[model samples]
Target: MIEVSKDGGLLTLTLNRPEKANALTAAMLADLEAALAGPPPAALILTGVGKVFSAGADLEEMQAGLGRNPAWERVSAAIAAMPCPTIAALNGTLAGGAMGLALACDMRLAVTGAKFFYPVMRLGFLPQPSDPARLAALIGPARAKMILLAGARIEAEEAQAWGLIERICAPEALMTNAQALMVDALAAKAGHIAAIKALIG
Candidate 1:
């Protein structure tokens, strides 16, 4: 499930199926895609409700053919296309296809103790098309290979050092830290934000 909240210029999208580690179902992916379908918000934060941000696609759903779903790419593409700043406020471990979402974000912040990995090699699936390039852009090509090929599970500290995540915060302070990063964007005009993002890109 996904929970959406709009606070003035900031829009927060939270993955809410904590009991299942927020494993994404087809419907959940559909909801996510729909949520980003309208005009882009001034700023957006993608986060999760429980200890784990997401365990990637739901196992049962994957077996039913969700693993190769185009929705994953669509959702990630939507996030990457947003003219406003987008943040992935990772609450815990990030694994599998979920890495695509975080990599698509303009920036990523994780809670201490969080782990990052993409086991597409071991799982016998290629990652969503754009994930590897986005990840490589953030952390470099070799390290991205370490994750996608060697299946290395990167700890939060290592992730920051390797440039995978921008910052690490205490679990309780994760959302606060994320909001802090959005303040400037939220205060700026949407067109101004877009112009700056374009310049940076």
Candidate 2:
């Protein structure tokens, strides 16, 4: 599920299913696409309502839907194509397809307790190859290779040092800092931001 809140030009989207570690479902993906397509928020922040940012696709549900589902991919692409600057406030662990969701954002800020990993390969599945390019662009090829190939979960501190995360904060302050960053982002000229994003992408 997703919850959206707007304040002073900042729009926050929270993944709100902690019982399942915020695992994404097809309906959630549909909601995300609808939200993204409906309006252009001044700045967007993605976060989790509970301990984990997202554990990834709901494995059990994914298994049932399998090849029949293309919604997740569509939603991911929509998030990546949003015109406004987008940020991911990783409150805790992020893994699997959820990792891809975070990568789609323009900036990422994680809590000190947060961790990141991509384990699609371990599940006997190939990851979206485009994610590697995006990760490399944000961090570097070496770090990206290490993460994807080894499937090692990197902590917030190391991720920040490696340029994977913009900053790391205490859990209590994660949303505060994320909103402050979004404020800064909203202050920038929208055209300029869009142009830069376009050039980079």
Candidate 3:
């Protein structure tokens, strides 16, 4: 459900079940949490192997209720708690809870074709803790409300304009740009990164 690898100081976690659009399960979330809990890295990248970063939680399990799946929220919170800079490599569309997870990242570098939306209102669920604040911080309160309240499906360009994404590159160029962005960020000492993350978080 999740694959993790490290190259130099960069740790990359790829959501494995691409056939299912990388929809998250409890096992997958636990895998993510366990990976995050280990020794800190200079930078961490969370992405999906194929199209669709994540389709959010599994709807079949969600039948039990949104509260039944708290692992996703825990994983999102863990990303924020990390001492290093975290990047959400948005290779594809992000929706529902997946958007919350991306919002938790310190930076989001997305492919220009990627789309995003938070359908909490349509789904009858509230945004996770820290999500509203994070979204508001990036795009401001009005646009945040427009997304959360209106269930707007935002395009990559619009999202970039709103400051929801740091940059939009061609799909093939996404990782290259992401790596370049993280190079300087990861150059800082771990202690300095931790202190700054604490301040921002």
Candidate 4:
């Protein structure tokens, strides 16, 4: 579900189920919430192994839960509200609710080969509107509409050009650069970072 490793102040969380395109399960989401809530790691990096960052929720598991459960909301909110700086390393394509998870992060950096898409409407679903405010803030409302409402998939280069991604790197460089960025973040004054985040939020 998730592989968590800590080195100094950096916490790296990897989505482990590549066989399923890293689609998140309920148990996996629970573990993710617990990991985020248990401690205040100086910085957090969320990524995925193999190809896909995440394909979104495990539809089978989600259907089993009937989409009415409160636990998912609680866990998602906890991740969104984590105190430390959080980065999403889009190691590959991201879709559906996984895009929501990426949106929860404070910043995003995608691999050169990565792609971003929001296809909830294709599934006869609606995205969590609050989750995309970060995307709109990073890009703009008009572009956000093109991406979200139009269900358009954008390549990493275009995303970077649009200011949706902080950086774009080759596949092998994604985690390395993300770690470097986290190191830089951890070196900054924590109070100042918190203040800036608060002011911006």
What shift in Å separates residue 112 of candidate 2 from its native position after superposition? 1.0
* Model 3: per-residue Cα lDDT over 1-201, one tens digit each: 899999988899988888888987777888999998889899999888787898887777678764456776788888988789889999999987778778988899998788888888998888776788889999999999998999989999999999999899888988888888788767788898888878865
Scored by Cα lDDT, where does model 2 land?
A: 0.82
- Residue pairs with colliding backbones in model 2 are none
Better candidate number, 1 or 2, judged by lDDT = 1
Better by lDDT, candidate 4 or 2: 2
* Residue 56 Cα positional deviation in candidate 3, in Å, after optimal superposition: 0.9
CA shift of 175, model 2, Å: 1.2
Error of 2 at 49 (Å): 1.2
Evaluate residue 112 in candidate 4 and report its C-alpha lDDT on the 0 to 100 scale: 74
Model 2 agreement with the true structure over 11-97: per-residue lDDT tens digits: 788899999999988878877878787667779889998889998888888688642467756766777888888889998999877
* Candidate 4 residue-wise lDDT at 79: 63
Ranking by lDDT: 1, 3, 2, 4
Model 3 stretches astray by more than 4 angstroms: 198-201
Q: Model 4 compared with the native: what TM-score?
A: 0.89
Give candidate 1 misplaced runs (Cα > 4 Å): none
Winning model by TM-score: 1
lDDT of 4 by residue, 170-197 (tens): 8999988888877766887777667777
Model 3 steric clash pairs: none
TM-scores for all predictions: 0.98, 0.90, 0.93, 0.89
